[model samples]
Target: MTGRQVIVRRARAEDIPGLVASSAGLFAEDGGTRDSSVNVDWPREHGARSFAAALDDPARLVLAVEHDGQVVGHLMGSLTGPTAKRPVTSATLVSIHVRPGHRRARAGDRLVEEFLDWARRQGAEHAEVTAYSANTDAVRFYERSGFAAMTVTLRQPL
Candidate 1:
């Protein structure tokens, strides 16, 4: 697993399928308690079309981690607003997914690195990502990549 073997690059529309597939299993494992089939349809169900639209937007950044000519991981983020008091620009990391086989091999790190680089290039003063509270591994991954726990989002279904 030499770092040189893996390449990180901006994602194209063609890469969406792979990114969606990579996330399906993780998404199911993390949530989707009511119906198992809900997990498999997450890509399209969660607005893949809108995601494609955003990916093509200049205001957004999407990157993929490729190994041996296959996209094994991907990360996406977008600029928000000067929502904070410090004249900050908010960037939300919409997604980060690595193929199961590529976990723990720095693929995730590379994706996050590219994401942060894109955010900084866009003049973002603050970056934020939401992770499932039950997903400890994801929390650790973000923390290891220099992210901190800012606030908790409590939800209640009506």
Candidate 2:
């Protein structure tokens, strides 16, 4: 459906199933293809508990985007306070996903916009997210959303 209206709002307990589904989709499309070690089944097996606790945490933001009264996307974020070595508060955009059919419709953008707004309000001095270096689409999306490279992590197989 082109030009359809989509709603972005804080996730409620009832949205957990949708959140889990979208997260599973992310794992399958992102980590599943990018890395062989990722457990694609984790969302289906453990997401309900994790997401439920997140819904109750004030330092966490779980957002769901719905179109035609069905969840089409989800975003998960967390706040981090200052530490001895790191004195600045921060927010991490933990995970995000929009159904393939719902992509290019600004659903992901809407989710990120809400997440950044929430992070700012929570006294976060910085916001960050990590996308696999090989995931060009995700990296481009994050760059377009105003994120730039802060660090590069090189890895070697054991």
Candidate 3:
């Protein structure tokens, strides 16, 4: 691994385009594009608006990880809570995506840490994330980041 420096920070409005690019990289992985029932082309106009909205929303966090002034990674997180089963507030790591070349540079860890800090400030008592069960690499990554499997999601192809 190269000793390159990476910066993780809150996403700015202008960062939408870069963030969307990373989002496309994410969707292309793990069949996200194929599995979607809706017709949504990521890194496009709609996605730009969505990222901008996320930046403005107080309840949501969008982070961008930059390497040498270029956005190579992004993460989205939000606070969820007060379900009938769980009364305590929790933070969900909505999604995270890093460019293929930037994995293992502690960028993912930094992203999670920042999100957790945000959740704690929002009075969240627990943290959670969901990953595709079939993606063993993702599962291991989350596990290393201190997440354990809490639910099993099963799907049927009709």
Candidate 4:
């Protein structure tokens, strides 16, 4: 789709539903699965409430990209603690997702651009984001947006 247009802007409480749906898509695409119906209902309610709260947080940034009047993507970035060990003001990209049909339209780039601008204005000196080690698409997106491999994390089922 050439010559397509997308708008990226601050998310409002009304966008919470779409935001949660996009988040579910991100989780699923990242290899997450639902074990029961409660899984969906729980996150749907909890995620919506969280996103709605973040929308009002001055220290956080939540932005959405819309196409043809429908929200197609969302990005959430947050300011992290600056302790002596990590003294610099850091902004961690909590999550970002673009609907399947919305990929390649630069919506993700626009979201990152807006988030970075906000993070900088809020005194963040460093930015970080984590991706599933095997989800190269997300890793590539972050790399293209100027992120480099900074740390390695390992996990195991307990």
Q: CA lDDT of each candidate?
A: 0.77, 0.91, 0.84, 0.82
Compose the digit string of candidate 4's lDDT tens values, residues 1-158. Answer: 33167788898888888888888777666646422222545446588888988988887898988888877889999998678898888998998988878777888888898889988998999899988777878888899999999889876656
Q: lDDT by residue for model 3 over 36-60, one digit each (tens)?
A: 6634464564778888888888889
Task: Provide backbone clash counts, one per model.
Answer: 0, 0, 0, 0
User: C-alpha displacement of 87 in model 1, angstroms?
Assistant: 4.4
lDDT of 1 by residue, 1-158 (tens): 76777788887788777666656655655556433445556665774675588777988887878889887877778887775655678788987787777775788888888788888998898788988887788899899989999899876765
lDDT agreement of model 2 with the native: 0.91
For model 1, which pairs clash?
Answer: none
Off by over 4 Å in 3: 1-4, 33-40, 43-45, 83-85
Better of 2 and 3 by TM-score: 2
Q: Tell me which of candidates 1 and 4 scores higher on lDDT.
A: 4
What order do candidates take by TM-score, descending?
2, 3, 4, 1
Sorting all predicted structures by lDDT, with the top scorer first, yields 2, 3, 4, 1
Q: How accurate is candidate 4 locally (lDDT)?
A: 0.82
Per-residue lDDT value at 111 in model 1: 82
